[model samples]
Every structure is written in C-alpha cells, then in structure tokens.
Target: MTEASKYGITLEKLRSRAAKGDLTQREIRAYFEPDERRGEAFAPAFKLTEFVDKQGKRPSARTVTELYFGAEMGVVSGPRARLRPRSRGRGITTTASAARMKVLAEGDSWFRLPNLSWPVSYPDDLVDVLRQTYEIPGVAMWGAEIGHMVTVQKNNYLVPLRSGLYRHFMFSGGGNDVLASVQTHVKRFGAAGTNPSSAESYLKASFDGALATVIGHYRTLAGHVRSVSNPKPTLYVHGYAHARPLPGGPYIGAKLEALGFDANSSLARKIVAAMVDRFNVKLKAFAAAENAAHPTYKVVYVNLRPAFTSAADWNTDEIHPSDAGAAKAAARMGDNIAANVPVA
Candidate 1:
C-alpha cells in the first residue's frame, strides 16, 4: 500500500481532519516520522513538544495537538523575543551587554526559523548566517503578517530602530501576508466562465488588489522607519523564492485542494509562481520608489529567487528552505549589504 493508504496522511485525509477540527500532534507526528520497518532514513524537521501547563497538568488531546503545532511551527501566540528597557528616559534600548549590535532584524519565520537537525547540523535561516557578521537583535516571530508587524507590533521594531546603533535593518516578511489569504487573491479556475489564457492574466485580473494592500503595509513600515529611526538605518527587504507545493507552505496542499486543484498540478505551480513573481516585481518597484524619494535612507530589495534551485535545498514543507538554501539566501543578502550599505 502507498504511504497515504498505510499512514492515512494523504492530502484528502488531512483536509478532512482539518475541516472537522484540530488535528492531534500524534497524527501529524506519525505521518512525518520515518517508518523503521520500511527502512526510511528521512528525519523530520518538525519536532513535537510537551503540552503540560505550569501546574503540571496535561491538557486535552486536542489542546495538546494545538500546542504542539503552535510550538513546532513557531506560531506567534505571544512575543517570541522582546527588547529590554534601559535606564531612565532612555526608553527601550539595547542592554549595555548587547549595545555592540550593528544590525536589527525584524520579520517572520524565515528570520527565526530553527536550525534543522535532520542528517547534520546546518544553517537553516538568515538569522544563523547574519549572526555570524553582526549581532542581530529585534522582533522576528513565526507566522507574522506584515500588517501586524507594521501596526500592532510597531514598537517591537520601531523602538530598536530609533536606537541609532543598527546600520542595517534586515526584514523578511510579506510572504505570510500574501500566502495566508491566497484564496482571496487568486480566483478558482473557470470562475465566472472565464478562460484565462495565461497565469499572468489570471493574476492580473485578481491578485493586484490584494498585492496592493500588502504594499500599503510596506509603505507604512517604511514611513515609520524613516521618521523614527535616528541615523536612519538602510532598510533591506526580500521576496520569496519560487516554492514547491509542499504541505508545509502555509498548508499549501490542503489550500490548493480546497480550491479544486491538485496540489502537484502544473497549474498549481504556475499559480504560486505567478504570485511570487508579482510580489518580487512589486518589491523591486517599492524599493526603487523609496530610494528615489529618500536618497539618504535607502531601501534595498535583495533578490533571493535564485537561492533554492534543487529539491534537496528545500525542506518537506517547501516554505522554509533547508540549510543549503538558507546559506544561499544569506550569501545573497550579505553580498547586497556589503555592496550597497557602507560600514559604520
């Protein structure tokens, strides 16, 4: 029997379970765990965590599963990292011990993705590589939307940006903003009896409005940074790479299935690719506009589409890259920072 038949972890099964209620950790874990009897050597990137409360009481199975998924995925239920407050009238500032930091990073899971421990130790995200050059201190959480980053959590990053210590500001967001509500942006094929000629056409007809909303958030972030930050740190932003339709990318498989498309279909890939392409294009445009408007405090768009080329470079989820993929993106970002922003 196939893995789906034997393991019951098929997309259809997962969709059904997701539709009904929360899926238990046991179910998701068992699905990803290698079958020793089958001699499968794969090691899952996701790890299960304990779900007991501080009172040492175990929650219900459903609650345990909810906590498991939240912890494993680094879901942002609360502040993942916080900036410490310093002396009087100083407000929130880096501690004296951490005052030497040169870069302030803020964004979603990519900035804080945990290291993969599958076959060996490797750099799984940009934070790992960035920490090599500069002490990165800021708020980067899992599943953070750009809108949240700009509005509700503004001070989380804004206060640090005003410190005048950071010369480079690395941001890794906008992916979640677009990916989370793709159903709204992308239309189902054959909708309104429309026979679109190309993926670009389909996207042009529907995704622009959603993309515009995301860009508005970016503008808000840029405006805040420009106004608040003393010495005005140069902003660095990146767009997502061409991703695979894996189950992990914002639950892509189920989302595609819900939209009446096979997760592995060419149309699905094209749809995702089109969205990513437009996002990158708009980012470049945004960077250009910002740079032209404010010559001193510039916005640099780091192109990371070429980072993950092979399947080996991507994790099973296909949203977060593997160690090799992260290294490539880090290299690209490092190169861009070096070439564009001068040293302090």
Candidate 2:
C-alpha cells in the first residue's frame, strides 16, 4: 500500500485534524508510523515539528506529507534541525534555546544571530546556496523553497516586490502592482489642487501610500509563513525582476525561448533591464534594513543565468521554472546571499 493508504486515513484527513487542532503529538506520530510490526522511524515525528516550526504554525497532514515528499525529492529539507541538550547538563533546554545554543555549539559552522533567522525555503537550495556561495559549515546540507503568500493594502492596494536579498520583501509579480498603486495615488492627490509647496506632505503621503501597501502585504505574508511554523524570521516580498533581456523579449521571455518559444524581441530586453533595476533597488533597501535590524544576518544578491538558457530548467510555460528550475534558482540565490552577507 502507498504511504498514504498505509496510514488507513487520507493525507487530507490528517491535515484536517492538524488544522482543527485535533492532531495531537501522539496522533501525529501514529500517522507517520505505517507499519505496526517494525517501529517507524522518529524522523517523521521530528519532521512534523520541523514542518510546524518552519511554517510558523502547525501544518495540515497533507502539507506535512507534501513537505516530506518534497524533501525526499531533494526539493527541500523536511525540517529544521532540532535543538538538543548537550550530554552535559546545562540546565533545562527548551526547543528555542536549543536552537540558539546549537548555533553557538556549531561555532564557526553556523552564521550567528539575525542571519540565522533568515527564511530558508528549499533545504536543498539552502545546501546549494551555502555550498556554492557561502561556506557556512555544519549546516545539514538541505535545499528547499520558502513557502510564502502575497498581500496588498486594503485602502491603497499595493503589492510587495519579490526580488531582494530578503525573501520576505521580494514578491513574484507583486512589485508591478505596488508601483502602479503608488503612481495612481500620486496622480490622484496631485490633481486635488494641493499646493506644490506641500511637496513634503505630498511625498510623505506617497511614501505612506506605498508603505501601507507593503506593510499590509507583509503582514499577510508573515502571518501565512507563521501559520506554517517556519522558524526563519518572515521577510515579506512579491517576485523577482531582472536587469538584462535575453535574445528573446525579457529575461523571463528569454527563459521562455529556452523552453522552446521564439521569444526574441526588443521589448523583452528593455523589460528585463527595467525589472532588474527595480529589483536591485528593492534588494538594497531590504539588505540595509536587515543589516540595521540584525547585525549578524548576512544579505547578498546574485545574478543568475536566465532559466531559458537550458531546456532542463524550463517549466511548463518556459517563462516560469519547473521544480528543477526553482531548485537551481534557490541554490544560486542562496549562494549569492551567503557569500555577500558579512559574517557576524
């Protein structure tokens, strides 16, 4: 019987229990232990905690199963490493304390402080990012993509940008909406016949307008990430933008071309550059804030080859990435950030 079938209950049913707070720790353990004769590995139980922690809250059984499968597929890590007390008694150790001590225990192997709190999406991506870019030792060497949701302001209707060193602020297809909203607000208030001398107020209003949109989106994203119990500090964002255009249209278009489309166009290149410029600015701001807020957290930006460059990287549409493409992007991005972030 399949893993799902072996449980005698559907994965969704398990998730429903988790969502409804019906799945207790004992029940969760039993859910993973399919065989009655041989004891099931504790790894599943451990994974449940990791899933809950990484998601910032308890996850549905289905979500846990998907994460497990994804981890097995090298898509990401099933769970963040659990903090355990040293053989020597150092008083009672809570999970949170253990994690902090573990970083310290790992010593140079781990990056300390705010940097440690950065969200990790794909465990394999984390491994790749760390291995290829930064050389933090003692990391379990897993890769995964951070799961995030997008939000906009209720009044201003702004979406957060996704491309940045901080995964929280960068959003996919989210920046465009934010920029448009800001522009609209600027025009609307400008036409109100407010004196140009109120430039400071106007600017503040515009910034507030943008900030409201960003904050609202971030709050929603943060809440969702938290709901998953993801341990990393939630960094809200939208999507990625690029600096250059490939022979096709933009980098995304070039990626499509790589996927087998005739996307070569002048507009594609312009769009790519524009997107890149915007992304860079957003990244810089995010990095600066992170650096200020958490001195130890490292933030870095990487320029990767367009996905369209290789058929292996193309998703169904050629524009988006397949699982492999997402993996590669995670790795490259992680590596870049790791390398650039100053070690605390």
Candidate 3:
C-alpha cells in the first residue's frame, strides 16, 4: 500500500471520497497546500517527453534530451509519434503501453523548459519533476502563448484527446501572455499624485483588458479539451510561481525597463507580484465556475505561488524556477493529482 504524507489526509481517504462522488474542491485544495515541501528523488521509471512540430526547428536542451527522450529526440517524423526510454540504463521501456500513458500535458515553456546550458546541464523542469511520478506525453513549446496552443498547435493536443488514451490532463500557460502585456500595458510613470507604492501607478488603463484576454484564451482551451475527452478526464491547470525581475533578464525585466519602471525597484517587484496574483485569482475563479457547471469533468487550478516566496527558489533568468523550486511546485501538483484522481 502507498503511504500518505504526515501533514495531510491520507491518499486512501481522498480516493474513498472520490469513489463515492462526494469529494469537494475545497477538500482537494486543503490537501494541496500542506504538501508543498514534499520532494521526490530523480528516479524516472518511465519516459518523460512532449511532442514538437516536425516541420519547425526544435528548442534547446540538446545535451540533456537523452534524460527525457533517450538517445534520439522523439521527433514526430511520421503520422503518429511515440516516446523512447532514457539511454542511461534507466528503467523506462522503449515503448509505453496505453495504460501507462494516462496523463496528457500542454502549455508553454514551464511545461517544456529547455536546458539552455552547454558545459553544465541545467535539466529538471516542471515536467521533469512531475514525470518522476506520471508519464506525461503531449505538446508543449518553449514560448507558447494560449493563442498559439489553441490554433496552430491545436492538432498536437486534440489528436491525443481524441484517442481516449489519457485520464488526466495538465496545463501551464498565460505567463507568456502576461509578459507580453507588460510591454504595452505599463505607463511611462505613475499616475499623477497617486502613491508610488501601488500597482496602479505603473499600470495603464488598458492593462485589465490584457488580463481578460488571458482568461478568455484559457476558457477556450478548456472548452476544446472538454469537447473531445471521453468519460470527462480531470483538467489540472497551474499558475506560475512568484517571479521577481532582474534588470538584465529577458522578457519581463527588459520589458519593464523599456516601460520606464526600474526592474530592480521595490515598486517594480510589487507590480509584477500584483499581476501574478491577479492572474492566479482569475484562474481560481475560472476553475470554480467550470467545476460548478460541469461537476464530473472538473477543472482544478493548482496555485504554485506559495512555494516560491523566497529569491532562492528562482533561477538567474528570473522567469523560470530553480531546480529546488521546481521540486517544491511539482510536489504540490503531484499531491493534488493524487488526491483528486486515482492512478494505477
């Protein structure tokens, strides 16, 4: 029998409630919070891989690809793509069975982060950490926005959903959308006479629209997933960690500086934090509404913000989490999934 953590209710109890169809969302979330500190060892019993466009140029992580995709990248060369095991004498088999491929994942860089390092290997992303427990196979690009996932990348995820091979779905997106908004939605300076300490000083009147756009795209994706997945698989979506800005960093930091806010200033960090919190709130609301309307095919939002309060949790890039930070967030996600859904 699998053991439950000392902090939260046992997995047996959660499965019992779920089997009887009485498990509430609040109860599942209660189990999510206390499991933030849990970490798993790096022993991959199965292949950890995602699908990439065969026609387009691949993303980074050339050296560490073997850790996830065995010797060769699982290039979708034919009509159907399949995963291979790791080359380093790992336990994963060359081909995965339908029963083993129960989880499907889709989203942006967080889902498909690359090991950009050359001499030194900076592996272990969110998927890498989570796959320590579940074998995730789907589509995730390095810089995918919600819009991209729904349109050009639609077939990549939809085809798998149509196959009815998966029982659980996971997603991570909208962070890139928020970063894109910072470039255009921030003001040159704070509003006249308003306190510099507030987020309103740095944001423009149109910024709220940007947030709405993210919510709308998320809804669209959820709707797409619902239309095809049979027996209504559980959809788990996660908002990003608390990412602070560095002056020299890319995207968020560079865009903030270009908009006239000092990327390293207290006000700037507060503004970023405010935006991130707002995004999470929107996600939480969406999950509630979606679940209320469709009980069996519930949408679960996993908040990763609490695990990343300290600076040490983030990498030098400031956008992505450090190895330790990824482990923390992954533990929360793995715990949430285990609590709500039963996996063989």
Model 3 C-alpha lDDT per residue in residues 171-246, reported as the tens digit of each score: 8888876655677777764543234467756666676787788889888888887897565678899878668889
Candidate 1, residue 269: lDDT: 71
The reply for model 3, stretches above 4 Å from the true place, is: 1-72, 75-91, 94-101, 115-120, 192-196
Q: TM-score for each prediction?
A: 0.67, 0.33, 0.70
lDDT of 3 at 261: 73
Q: What is the C-alpha local distance difference test score of each model?
A: 0.63, 0.33, 0.63
Q: Which candidate is the best by TM-score?
A: 3
lDDT of candidate 2 vs native?
0.33
Model 2 CA deviation exceeding 4 Å by range: 1-13, 16-264, 289-298, 305-313, 322-331, 337-344
